[model samples]
Target chain A: MDTHDAKKPLPRLTPDNRAFWEGCREHKILLPWCQYCDRPHWPPGPVCPYCFGDDLTWKQSSGRGVISSWVVVHKAWLPAFAADIPYNAVQVELEEGIRLTGNVVGASNKTLRVGLPVEVVFDDVTPEATLPRFKPR
Target chain B: MRDDVAIVGIGQSEFGRYLPISQLGLGAKALQAALTDAQLERKDIDGLSLHMGWPLGADYDRMAEVYGLEVDYVHQSWTHGRFVTSSLQHAVMAVACGMAEVVACITAISFTRELSILGGPGDPEGMREQGATHGENPVYGLTSPAVGAAFALQRYMALYGATSAQLAAVPIALRKHALLSPYAVMKQPLTLEDHQSSRMVVDPLHLFDCSLITDGAAVVLLTSAERARSMPNVPVYVAGMQGVRSGRSEFIFAPPGLGINQQPASPTTPRERDLAVYGRAGIGREAIQGFYTYDAFSPLVLFALERFGFCGPGEGASWVQGGRIELGGELPVNTSGGLLSEAHVCGWNSICEMVRQLRGMAGPRQIAGAEALQWGTCWGDSVIMRR
Candidate 1:
């Protein structure tokens, strides 16, 4: 049983996600836009699933939304998450109408509300990694 | 499709947190087990279907080499949790459509290195570009199926007030059944308190709520039902099959609050649509003997039970609150321990369990020698219940 929860601890950047990370580095949340449907997407994508369009563009976000759902982590299956035992994990529905799941910093399950207003912030868990985390507006 | 394809044999590798087995080795063991169970020589097989799981990239080629057959026909269907039933359906359809006489379908995981915390390992360039559904969900808390299932579990609570004890029943009855299942992992007595105390990967879905990223494999052998009767193992017939999908556009949706109770209903879900997986057998829910479902998430078992007509909508809470899904319950499900107690050999274990029950070899998990078995795939893509 090589259950090595050993942390190699590098956020390797791949080609498809490169531009998205670049946007994050510049403090701009971005999504891929398909020329076919003509709407910006939360997650960067190549083919527009709705219209089957391949042409896409990355667009910036206002980074605003209401908490559609949330849960408090009292436990974790891996050692990477073991230290942050009591954290608030949330599914925030952005103003652009994209719903995403992430951690809400400076809060716990007891304080999370279904409709709490939130804004995005970046936390570099590792030097090579800068992840988007949310907080109370 | 061939109206008479039946599962004549089934087998699985020992499952657990870790094991010293190659994906190919585990697959060969399971394939050999099925061959022995069916009492057929390896030369009898011609068709094959393999789920391209998160194992070694060369699974299909390696399996073909070890099994000593130049596979005549093969199917590669892959996806998340509900993939087990879906994979079996592909194998059956291959046989049904006149592809081959004997077909073996399997899934295997051998290395801890192959497992990905967010999603199964895939071509990075091909994967990250997958859009809102796969892309953003992973970046958020849903990187793992357990986290993805937590989203649904939270909704299950808001809708039916489903309790932790009720949810624990999914793993508890399973572990009890695993006492009889030689291949299952996590079989020790685990209480709701134990589940409550287990580390939570995502709230609502705990460690136990998540299926193991195990190292093992399961294989099933199928042939025309008439041929199966002459064979030694109990003959189980292929009954019905169907597949369902929700929020097909962008993966994320607020699940519009139709009545504005200001809340979302339990997802209408792929498994919820009464698509006819068991309709071909002409057996109703009450007459159906055994049920095997994909349990990538703990809440999915309950979803299948409620959606598949074991109980009415929103009655999942009362359905498995105690020992309802165990051996003596009105319907016994996941007798081979499902994905929770069993290893996560993708969804292959569920197919093997279904065959085991139909053959009356389920031992401790056996449900009074059932004549029929119903198995749901990829939530509800297909339900192949047979007698």
Candidate 2:
């Protein structure tokens, strides 16, 4: 197993969201599917935002989305990302109708555009976490 | 509630970095100055309304205790420019309801240690039991408010063909105004070329487009119109004021679900809450002579210009192209250099400028024959002051 020092901020694994992180380790994208509303959402929460129902479950994602908007960070505010200056942070709208935030790995700042088609590519940055990244499809 | 409340005194601390003093010290200095300016002592103040953005280590009760003044009425709004006007409204209502005779509205921000208002690793809201998320963006490398604002700017440019030159003019004009302002932090004059050639913190936004992070505080003294008339400074009446929070729940960086589309569907459209502020004040758009919009980012100026009906949507870039927003222009905007060059104390700096313009105390930067001055945040907080 290959791991690096936790230089950047990392997500803590919790009971309600452990499945999503665990699934990421296996190269599977997971989102919360509410039993009450039958709708999936991102940045998993305790209950359905719309219905507020406790009946919720995990669902696999289709792994496709569009670039709703994006920004190229030329300056790094944190020491961890100093080496990665000039990276792209993008807002991706999944085919499942959920919007997730990630960076597009294979695109330049000049090339990125709104509504650009993108597909998810998981990066096993550390042994404990796998970061989701996007690339032009 | 309209003609009943008037701002009689205004005070501000030096807006650059002040070390060894917490936000409390800065706020107390401004409050004391305001009390003296109003020709009243701390004991005369019975109401306190404060807008101190989050990570606030103290509250209204704490401030009252520190000053040894007992305020009969108190209200607080936490986090950013949107709350400053809301805090002012609370003071107006407090005086109208007889809760307090003299109310003081204070706002302050300290970045001496170089604190970032944008979510950081220390943010409680950014922390989760499983992992830390960067506010709504939730991305590894992107952590500043500029990132979210850049996305909106890109959409605006795509839709209206607004160019960088048009956006650069906003900062350039404001910087020129700052030269005349003795309290301004950025004393150097700025040009359109300097704005265009500056480093890009985020795409479609330059380093100059963002605001100055400094340690400063501003205070406004509000009282009944009858009492204000006796004060030393001329009374600037609060003619019409209103605040509206967006009901849209979907995050800006997040995509809406299939049935749920991202609200405020157009990033640049003037919101209903904006129009309501004008209607509430019973003043038509043409009556406003001076203007100030929250300039946390430069593109926001364009959003506000159109939102307040100063110009049609997509015409803001051209509206400010000539010297229209300068001191001699028909309608002067941000005569105090605003957040870009003046110093960003949330909205306090702008509010103080509006007060000065209406009182004819702005000196060289003063807009002559100014009848009314209006100030608002991009998020819908608004206030109109009449001479």
Candidate 3:
């Protein structure tokens, strides 16, 4: 039996979210802004879900924020992340006021609390994707 | 809402990660069980509705085909946000509106696998691919569901003084009931010690506080009160139903509602999120003998109970102390075990439990004199009924 089929490799990229991928590629995190409310959404909506407005724009983000909350995973589920046994996976409330997730590279579990100070930086795991992550101030 | 619609049949299967069976097989099992309990035939169903997970959920045509159900109407519904009883409310409306003789609803999850929280990538081409298609949730390293549901949980704990134990209670209470329920995914009696010992998923929320990705399905059949009264099973009426969509914009805070920056609107003032639901058909909050809010995440449970008016805002943690939410407690919840221990069949099994309580067929775990089992089918809609 081929282990390739047994292990469902995760998705790389698709058309709908290509803009977000492209935004990340250029070293600028992007969010789909509602043309009506002038607000940005993380899981980009097809339409302005708030005002039912059809118009939307992709806006750049500062990629700066504080850690709202985090967890330290002692176990690894797959090959890609196993090397780093204990990592702080966090939900950072970005400066945009939108809560996006990232990993905390420089903190232990006890040090991570509900409202702690932090900032976002990029970790290029692959040649194409410059992933957003955070560290203590 | 009219007092004419009623639930005449209900069914549920064993819960857990059953990668071996397909979703269709679970649906079939539920169909057979419910049909037997109601003493009705598959040919009796006319109108239909089904709600479940992604990819497997987006395909309405496929569900109808696999079940061999020639439904007159159908709706698969949204995410965990969409409650199960909400579908029952619509089916009740269909029966009341003179649409058909009978309506049936089912959920199948035998093959619905879970994604690793470690940013295991995503399904891009599938219709259920949803919005965030392009990148890695892992590179920055925040990928687990505990962390996904953390901000809101933290906010709830901060505001209400809700402890990790209070959060753990939601799952432990359900695990107790699961021992009584053959269909429940967890059978082991989980103590507060067991609850505390479970590894932390996110800060504050331990693994036990989260819901299991179980394999199972549940179905409910409904018809006019007049028709249900004539059926072999006891009659339970559809009392009242209400559902609303807060423009995805209203809840700018994702998951459990945490704003990354300033909220799209002022966060101080409550914007119609509160009192969206009353507890019941008769006595309101005072009369709801049991509660069945979704417990996919413990903090979500706290927020749900508060938002739905079980307690005052930020008072959920305090009110659930010293076995208050346990099986024999005043406002007994998840008496049949909630999604945390019973498996999240997308809250379908919760609706089944409520209906069984009202019909007085919930053998061992049945609440005494439960005239109605008010349920939340979707966060958008709430269901309240009477005997």
TM-score for chain B of each model, two decimals: 0.86, 0.91, 0.86
* TM-score, ranked from best to worst: 2, 3, 1
- Top candidate on TM-score is 2
Name the 10 consecutive residues with the lowest summed lDDT in model 3 chain B. Answer: B260-269
Better of 1 and 2 by lDDT: 2
Q: Which portions of model 2 miss their true places by more than 4 Å?
A: A1-5, A12-22, A34-38, A41-57, B18-20, B53-57, B114-125, B128-139, B249-273
Model 2 Cα shift for residue B208 (angstroms) = 0.5
lDDT for each residue of candidate 1 in B1-387, tens digit (9 for 90 to 100): 424788888877777656777767777888888898899988898888777544354456666786688778887665345455556777778778778888888777753646553442232322344432322243332344454456556655765677776788888777777677778776587787998888766777778877766788778888887788899987777776665444432121112221111223335432334545555556666777767777776777876776666776567768886677887876777887777787777777877777767666767677785777777532345565455
C-alpha TM-scores of all predictions:
0.81, 0.90, 0.82
Instruction: Write model 3 residue lDDT over B1-387, tens digit each, in one string.
Output: 446888888887766684566777777888889999889887788877767645454356776677676767765664433446566667877888788778887777643464532234442222245623212243433344444456556655654467887777667777878788767868789989988998865556677877776778888888888888889888778776666444433332222233322224222222344433452244465777777766677666655565565666566677777777777888788777877887778777777888888878778988889885566521335677678
**Model 2 per-residue lDDT at B180:** 88
DockQ of each: 0.24, 0.44, 0.25
TM-score of predicted model 1?
0.81
Q: What tens digits encode model 2's per-residue C-alpha lDDT throughout A96-128? A: 877777788866768888789999998888787
Candidate 1 regions with alpha-carbon error over 4 angstroms:
A1-41, A47-62, A72-86, A121-132, B52-58, B77-80, B111-127, B131-143, B244-274, B309-314
